[model samples]
Target: MRVRLSPAALLTIFGNCVKIKSVNSIFDFFSWLAMAILLITAIPQIVLNYKRGSTEGASWLTFGMLFFGMTVLAIRSWFVTTDIIILLNYNLGAVIVLIANMQFVYYRIKK
Candidate 1:
């Protein structure tokens, strides 16, 4: 059976619609879209690493830089505003980077 995804479902999962005050509705939608895309940018590489049971194709340096960058952005977002979408973007990016980093460690140790 094929499952259908509604726009509401996508917004519910990726967009903090309720929490975000509407400044311009179009801009707000695009902002959430951009944020969601940025947040998941690392997922493909992470999944690839996991499936391969190795991080050979991934770079520790890149993940380290991403973790550092995301941490800084999350910290800045925490201090600057309480916008849920912004907060989620940076914070979730950090978590994703950390998970990738952990995979690096795990696979390295296993070798």
Candidate 2:
């Protein structure tokens, strides 16, 4: 038995599928891009602290609050699902913040 399909129907299905995939691809790209940018954003602070040999504007309260929040968020992401990108980025950010926090403590004591 042979069945005939209309060209318009096929075109419509193909077009919708392509549209959905494109949107998904765009979203995935931006999500991971933001993750990468956030992961690296902490480096400058560390560098500045190194160059200055002290932590000036970087407040302990700010660092503590940010790290705590990030840690909580990462934990939540872990419990909810295994999103490696989210887990890695948030944890890395927390670690970087910890490094900065330690530099502050050390430099303050030295000064």
Candidate 3:
């Protein structure tokens, strides 16, 4: 006996095999990892400022600019994914950075 496969069926089978292998998707994992690094870098600065009770050498203007830019990026990232992990990570990072900047401004002004 002989078997015949339609073009559409063959394509679907190939796609399924690719998916099963987990090697055919175009999603870039590194971009999110980079965003995570950006977030992590903010932590020590925040901790230091908190511990010292001052933002003496820190530039509020720099943080303000970054906060604004990241806010825009976070908004743009929203429509790009249904993945809760990505959305939450970027948004939370933005919020934390914004709050840290505000604290810096407050401490600078208070001193």
Task: Provide C-alpha RMSD values for all models, in order.
Answer: 14.6, 5.5, 5.5
TM-score per candidate, chains pooled:
0.64, 0.60, 0.64
At residue 29, candidate 1 shows an lDDT of 77
State the lDDT at 25 in candidate 2: 80
N/CA/C clash count, model 3: 0
Q: Deviation in angstroms for 104 in model 1?
A: 0.7
Q: What's the CA error at residue 76 for candidate 2, in Å?
A: 1.8
| Pairs of colliding residues, candidate 3 | none
- Where does model 3 exceed 4 Å of error? 1-28
| Cα lDDT of model 3 by residue, 9-103, tens digit | 99999999988666423344665675678678777788888899988777788788878877886898798878787677668868978988888
Q: Model 1, residue 66: what's the lDDT? A: 80
Off by over 4 Å in 2: 1-41
Worst 10 residues of 2 by lDDT: 34-43
Provide the overall lDDT of each model, using Cα atoms, as 2-decimal numbers. Answer: 0.82, 0.78, 0.78
Q: Give the TM-score of candidate 3.
A: 0.64
lDDT of 3 at 96: 78
